[model samples]
Target: MVKMLCDPVCPPPNLSQHPCCTVKCWKWDVNQITMNNLVKYGILILNRPITQNSGFIKNLWNRATIRMTVDGGTRQWDKFISGLSNEMQTTIKDPDLISGDFDSITDEILEKYKAKGCKVIHTPDQDRTDFTKAIMELNTHRKQTGLELSHIIAVAQTSGRFDQIVGNIQTLFLVKEELLLDPNTNVFLISDDSITWLLMPGDHVIYIPEETRQHKRAWCSLVPVGETCKYCTTTGLKWNLDNQSLRFGGIVSTSNTFDGSEKVTVKCSHTLMWSMRLPTIAIS
Candidate 1:
């Protein structure tokens, strides 16, 4: 068993320092998850090299060191690779790495990132998407860098095969508690304090930022596998729901706006997923 020595100011000597005390066993009774953890390192993982439409490419231009993994898809590989060149030039300025099996990836694009000295490793695992492998690689990098894995803004995680999307999200639930990821694991979002992960069946409050401010988009959500949420209560959205029961077939909250300015709270009788977006910032 791992032991922790905690002082108010400094952490224990020679002990692993997690971004939050939640990773380690804490003696203090914390009421709920908050947004305080967003201030630290924010890691973004993109599954498959970006497919840049004119609009999507422009939006991703500002992000730094985007580690991308290309997938082996049934789509037209040549056309995808040819179209990506110009967009890669326009949107990606950082040393973005491209990795995955070469089945769907072209020789031209592989040479491009490689020539630029971006680290590339080809792991042709048939059991998982290249995306899943990339996430594991990022986890290893996180441990090596001594940074806790944060919000992963993954593209193509859901847009690919329907089964793949479900599988990727399912992996989120299996993540060890110490890893501490946002509820929507495959999305590019984060919280300032802490993201509330689901529990079995009980009443719990999730802290959220109130909407009445400058930002119009403040909230987002994901349904857990099987989507068996019996009931949920939220206090931050523009439309408040009390004792509302939601399931797989019902309304799945994807893009919900916030109403308050400071923080909103959520209570659920069953396990539920809720996440807030964070501004894109660079980490060293």
Candidate 2:
């Protein structure tokens, strides 16, 4: 049976040792993850404007073991906190690091954060996007600090330029190799209305919050990336896939809603990009 819990408890056990075991559990409720527990997650803000739920962002910032911004993301972060109340602003911590090619961030904002003792990493690689470069920095930071960050949450948006969105998704595919992170290190992209991540070829269980499962408009999708998912099966979705093929020109699961099940199960033959619509969360 799949283990499911609302609170951030212990890390999932190693089921790989059991040849018949292939289940991996996932939980996305950052708000419930407290600092009292092990700091196993990091947060990265991309250049896209953070127009998502402020309270949700606040929880992520407060609970993150490492916080960073990429290029113009510095300006975006500054703008985000500037709108918060003085009391709220005081609760948020300064970013631990700021990195980019230094093209988008203004000198004033850059200096301000530097004055706050944030590390500045100048990455001028024209081949990689700032987002990808930021992940490289994250890997370096992990080596220097010896912090075991098992998960990475990147704050970005999906409504911007289409190419930028696709580029962000492409970065997910390169995370393990470029960042030199563990194969199990999960990376997620959170936008104004959704959370997206890559699902490797395996069995997976995604625990949905009760509120989101009941939300009338909540949706989820699984799209094959890079190559077609030759064999994909799912449960707990309004339209479950039964040994179906998912490809760009073939049958793709989009705008699919939940079937009121608290958890969804997926078994796939190849890497698939999974995304779920976030419920309307109250801003603090």
Q: Give TM per candidate.
A: 0.54, 0.87
Question: Highest TM-score: which candidate?
Answer: 2
Which residue pairs in model 2 clash with each other? none
For residue 76, what is the lDDT in candidate 2? 96
Across 86-150, the per-residue lDDT of candidate 2 in tens digits comes to 99899999999999998998999999999999999999999989998888888889989998876
Each candidate's lDDT (Cα)? 0.43, 0.79
Give candidate 2 misplaced runs (Cα > 4 Å): 1-38, 177-179, 280-284
Q: How many clashes in each candidate?
A: 13, 0
User: What's the true lDDT of residue 81 in model 1?
Assistant: 45
> Candidate 1's C-alpha lDDT?
0.43
lDDT of 1 by residue, 1-284 (tens): 11111111221211234334232211211111111222222333344334434233333333322444444421222233456567564554433445567676567766766776767777688776565666666666556667543245444433556776566555444443334333223223222222223332333333333321235444456454454666766665677667777677776666676665344445444445654443222110
Residue 214's lDDT in candidate 2: 82
